[model samples]
Target: MNENASSDVKAKRQILIGLSGGLSALADRMRSQHAIATKITTLAARAEAIAQRSWDLNKLNSQDLQRTMDGFVGEIKTFAKQAIDAAVRAGSEALLGKEVAEAIAAHSAEIARLTREIDSLPDAAAVRAILQPLSVTLNTLPARLKANTAMLKDVDAIGALATGLAERGDALAAGGTAGNRVAVELSRDLRQFAEEATTFSLKMASEAALAVKAISDMAQRTLGLSQGNPVSDQAPSATDRLMTLARTGPQAGQVWATSVSRTSRSSPVQGTPPGVKW
Candidate 1:
């Protein structure tokens, strides 16, 4: 191949390698996000179970239950936001630039909008309406992350192919003209791959943010925490309350689980109508 053609192929090869590296990094991010999603899902389930048990045993009134749900939701919202911010920051530092900043702003706007909707949830039923859908969405997160990771891998493979083709000029063509055409096609493929990555990241972040925001907003409203106001003595923020509850919730969940297991194995123990027998 001519000197100019060889230089062009080398440049395209570099681009392909860079693209593949970005995809690999994104796949790693998705793996980490998948773990976060799994934890959120488990947290939602535990909170819901605790709410149900409290309600059934009349340990909390409807309003109180709503408040508790709000607190948990607040905690989740903070968690989700932190996760997104961290992921975006990490991506920006590693594989991204302005692309992630735009996406983060968009997701933040959506979360704010959902917060208004969550504020309208006045009762336990309303709280459940928001929480249930979020729980369901979070339940699907593992699958979504798996698919995204697979997609990144597939794109990375394509980049590798393009890089290989660029490096081995004779593999695609015997002459300068053929080599030029291969370079043009490889450049086009790189552009398309970059666009796909941007789009995919935006979509993934949007879905995760929206689901968590919806539930978090609901919980904040239930707890009567004013979004516009700063946290104070009378009305602590949902995240704050959730932190307090979280300290005890794990032990409570463990006890509840043990009680449930024992009951499932044995005949129902006679108890007062309203109390659960362990």
Candidate 2:
């Protein structure tokens, strides 16, 4: 009977050991599941916060773009007003025909009105539609005025108009921050206008003896504007490069002339140029 009791006690101890080991493994699994649940909650909260911030940023950017557009429109109106005033003054002085002055004022008014309409545009495409005709009008104005004999006779009047337009264009270009595509394009347009005005001034200067002083002043301002505001980091076109060089002095002009002659001689000719023999 004593031997039987000893075996029963050994079996009971073995059953207790098995129960303890099973309970320990169950506790470990519960802890692992709790850790995984906590990690999932943390990641979800982080993602939600990021999404909210992104939405706010998009709203701010949209507001900022509208403000920029408004500022650009204001500058354009100012530009049109000043140019119109110059043309009207010249007309009153009999430097150009009254019809010409009326035409200029009419064109400028249309440009200003169109510029105001840009504020109501829904997207870039609509704005570009307005800008297309506006650009053509702006580009053709100086040439049209230059074609009139009466207008070209008064060099001072032409100089006044050119300089005024250029100054206002510079101001308009300053309305936006760096990296803004609109500002960069406006700056390029200003430079091109300056170059064309300078060319016109030089051509008229050759014909008028007493107009030297007016031409000099206009050249100085326009050249300064062109040099100061570059649209990009890319190298300037060959025409622009030579134009800049030609502005320095007579010596620079001579150097450009020599280079042109050399290029002409060295270039291979597939056919004779117009008004030239083979």
Candidate 3:
């Protein structure tokens, strides 16, 4: 009878061991599923945000729009790369689990899609075309101002000439031949005054042109940065994700295992008699 009882106990232990193993496997599968789901959700959210930003940028003019669009494109690319790295790391953590690999592959596809979309956007040529007129106008402003200054200088000279002629005529009328010399001197002074006035007008025009040129240069630079070549290459790499997963997965697994062990230990054993007679 004792031998039979011993055999029964051994069989029960074997069953328990098999059940525990199965439960552990199930838990791991569930965890992997959760990780994948989380990753997918994250990627979707990122994509949505990127799309929205793109739409917003579309509303702006070429000069105003490209900066915002470029920023969004860069961010999307960066997020996608980061996601890929995370997936790779997660896969490594789960011992190269299928779910992790699937997630990573999905992210990679998304990144590629974003890249293509960004590349397909209108090139700087179109932007330049739009801005070229403005640039030309700006470039011409200084010359226009300078011409205006020259015209003003001529006006000043005319005014000065008029004043000197009037003075000389008055002196000649009052003192006749004796005032003649004085009149001639006054005439020379008037001519000098007219020339000074012309110079002043030209100076004003030059100053205005300079101011306009400065503003134009600033606007052009801003536009160039927005639509310029060689967009930033700040996306995350696959290796980065793998390393993160390596660091976090073991810790996560340990926490899960500990919780399971505790819960299992705490639970009352099955098949125990409710009321046993000793």
Q: Which candidate has the highest TM-score of all?
A: 3
What C-alpha lDDT does candidate 2 achieve relative to the native structure? 0.33
Angstrom error at residue 202, model 3: 74
Best by lDDT: 3
Badly placed stretches (over 4 Å) of model 2 are: 1-63, 91-187, 201-278
lDDT against true structure, model 1:
0.34
Provide TM-scores for the models: 0.24, 0.22, 0.27
Model 3 reaches what TM-score against the true structure?
0.27
Task: Give RMSD to native, each candidate.
Answer: 31.6, 39.3, 39.0
Measured with C-alpha atoms, the lDDT of residue 174 in candidate 3 is 53
lDDT, candidate 3, residue 176? 33
lDDT measured at residue 124 in model 2 versus the true structure, 0 to 100: 42
Q: Can you give the lDDT of residue 131 in candidate 3?
A: 38
How many clashes (backbone N, Cα, C below 3 Å) per candidate?
A: 1, 0, 4
**lDDT (C-alpha, whole model) for all candidates:** 0.34, 0.33, 0.34
